[model samples]
Target: MQDFLLHGILAISAIHMAHCNPDKREKYATISARHQNIALSQFSPGLTEIGENNADAYVLHAICIFLVNTYSIANPQGPITSRDVAQSFILLQGIRSILALPFAHRYIFNGPLARWLYQGSVEPAVGGNYSSKIDDLLNLTRSMAPSDDTLTCQSALEGLKHTFAAVSTPQHRKGLVWRWAVSLPQSFLELMSQNHPMALVILMYYAALVYAFERNMWYLTGWGSNVASALDKAIQEPWREWIQWPLRCIREGVDIRQVEPLKPVEGNPRTQLPTINFNLGLFKPSEPPP
Candidate 1:
């Protein structure tokens, strides 16, 4: 089983590399041309086409399929192997990289430009009903996130601090959860209403990836194996349908089930923080004390 998993990963990796190597050049050209034509301020073009068409998704999907195949070959309806779990981790990593690129490299992913594009499109119309709230939620989570640029993240942190201050009351926190819980399914339905199946797929897959990462990170950090086991148990559809749904019953706010659980991950610094450079530049004396 392990041999099968290893061979499958190698084959998938080789194929994805060969496939994407040629397309990467073309993809870059297409993306750059699209950006050049778009003014980027008043209007933006979405990943609507690009996201669906990206090589990353194809590569990740291929690897995932291979992983599942390997699992089935080995277990044939029984226990999932470590290889299977590891492959899931790899898939999550790929997805995270794909998602983070939009924010990490604005020149490439261009959040503002994408949002502008969404706004300009007949699809999301400027200040449209769903656009504002969805954008707000995404932006809020992204802003609270820690990232490579200290200044950029600091600004976001400040905004979050202020936002949290304004809405920090226990009641408000509960209300926020309640509101999100109520809004989640509605948002899911809204996406469906637009015939946007990708949105639902992306949302659900992203959520699952988030849960998996949280579990593995905790396990790696020396959290008792029980948490990891609980996570594994949580992913099953039956468990997700029953226990997971009720997990959000507390306080009836923000539907904790809908949001990814944040876990404190302890690991190699290099792995965790690839983009950050810790060196501080030398300080110069101010014009001989003026």
Candidate 2:
């Protein structure tokens, strides 16, 4: 398991060197590809039969996969396609699957990893100044006329508001914002996969969050402007109105602390966030799996 993590770290380091060390860039880039391939090859098999003991390994492997791909897609000259953002979130969701493993909390509380284990505990805020912005997007989804995709779109947006609320507090962790996708349904992932306009709009919000928090990262650079630009082209006329703020954020780099979070829609339980229990603070059972 550590071997996979080591390969992933090496791959990421080499890519950084490739970009920064121009003279040896080609050599470093080639080394990165080689290590990335090996790490990913190890990851694909690990996903199939995840158990308590192996769950930690899966989580580490997924992080490697996520970082490797994010770096691979980054291009100072190229656009960050909607597919890139969508695929990144998809990889993020893979981390949640590991937490869902039975009795996961035992491992969840490990030192340094504890915050991630319990981050799901925070719910979307009720009636905050910035929450109205999230509300507007929800209303826009409703105004567009209800469809099967509505709930998934709403859910994805709702998750964003929840994340906004989480990050607003002093307890916020560095990678915590990425957890917004952890609650997404397969249906929502499908919508993003389809490049549906509404889904793309939600992705724009994600782009803003990443831009606000992660723009300094080499792989994450330009994600904001590129995602906004791609969405600008991918989304048609009327839909443009809903994405204004995200575009503004991409253009102006708005402080996320001041942004409105989306409140759960009144009377809509589906939009309401509940405390997510990853089974933290539990002891591993003495008996092994049968």
TM-score, structure 2 vs. true: 0.79
The ten-residue window of minimal lDDT in model 2 covers: 268-277
Largest TM-score belongs to which candidate?
A: 2
Cα-based lDDT at residue 165, candidate 1: 29
**Candidate whose lDDT is highest:** 2
RMSD versus native structure for model 1: 20.1
lDDT of 1 by residue, 1-290 (tens): 22323333443343333223544633533343333222121111222333433424333332333233322222122333333332333333333334444433344344332431111111112342223333444464365545433233233323322322223333333112111111122233333234332232223222222232232222122111222232334345432432232222221222222343333232221111001111111111111111
Residue 121 error for model 2, in Å?
2.9
lDDT of 2 at 226: 60
